[model samples]
Structure formats: C-alpha cells, structure tokens
Target: MKPIDPRLLRYARATRLFLTAVVALGAVGAGLLVAQAMLIAEVVVGAFQHSMAAAELRTPLLLLVAVACGRALVGWLTELAAH
Candidate 1:
C-alpha cells in the first residue's frame, strides 16, 4: 500500500475540529435515540403487560420526553456544524 501524503494531512487539519464535533454529536444522537426507544418500550410494557398506573409510569414518560428533546437538540447541532 502507498503511504499517506503530507499535503493531504495539511488540508485536513482545518476540517478536523468540525469532524470531531460532528462525530461527537452523532454519538450523542444515537445514544439519545436508544434511550428514547428503551423508554417507549418500558412505558408500553409497564402499561400493558404490568398494568402500571399513570403515576407509576410518570418517571419513564418524563425521561422519554427529555431524551426526545435531547435528540432534537443534537440534530440541530449536527446541522449547524455541517453548514
């Protein structure tokens, strides 16, 4: 295999920070999505299988909302960074 060119590294330096930001934001978004899905599943299971009261489901429901909001914020950040 050929070695990397030094000139390419020099040009890439400028984008390295932006690339890092995008990667970080993407990771955060993915985590939030997972949390949101898990929360939804929990809420469904608790309400249906376990027949949990609304009061008992409150925490998970609130967490789901927070995770959704976090995902939206991350998406906005990613878009801003890309531009």
Candidate 2:
C-alpha cells in the first residue's frame, strides 16, 4: 500500500466535514418534513384548514442542492490542494 501524506489527511478531513454537514442537513430536512406533515394532518383533522404554514421549503432544498454541489467543489478543491 502507498503511504499517506499530511496534505492528503487535511483534504480528507475537509471532505469529511462537508459530508457530515450534508448528513446533518439531510436529517434536519427530513425532520422538517415529518413535523410539517404531522402539523398539516392535525390542522386538517382538527380545523379542516388547507394551507401551508411554511411555504419556503425551497430554501433548505436549495441548500441541500448546494451541499450536493459542494461535494464536487470541495472534492476538486481537496484534490488540488492536496497535490
């Protein structure tokens, strides 16, 4: 096996950080979805209301998309920085 370099280690750490952020954000987004669903269901059952309390799900989704885009950007940056 080849030996690992310190620079590569730093890059690896950066990649891991971004990946962790992605995972955390995904968890938050999923929680939001569940919470919203429950709230909407309760409202519908209790008050028979049919309106979105929060109509800005696009922001977090966009952030998710940005994080996905960051996957490539950070990976490329890490590779370039490592070398």
Cα lDDT tens digits for candidate 1, 1-83: 99999999997997888899999999999999999999999999999999999999999999998999999999999999887
TM-score (C-alpha) between model 1 and the true structure: 0.84
lDDT of 1 at 70: 92
Deviation in Å, model 2, residue 37 alpha carbon? 0.1
Cα TM-score of candidate 2? 0.45
Give the Å error, residue 8, model 1: 7.0
Candidate 2, pairs of clashing residues: none
lDDT of 1 at 49: 100
Point out where model 2 deviates above 4 Å.
1-10, 49-83
Model 2: per-residue Cα lDDT at residue 46: 42
Compared with the true structure, the alpha-carbon lDDT of candidate 1 equals 0.94
Worst 10 residues of 2 by lDDT: 46-55
Clashing pairs in 1: none
lDDT of 2 by residue, 1-83 (tens): 98989999998887886666666655655665565566445545444344434334444445545655555565555455444
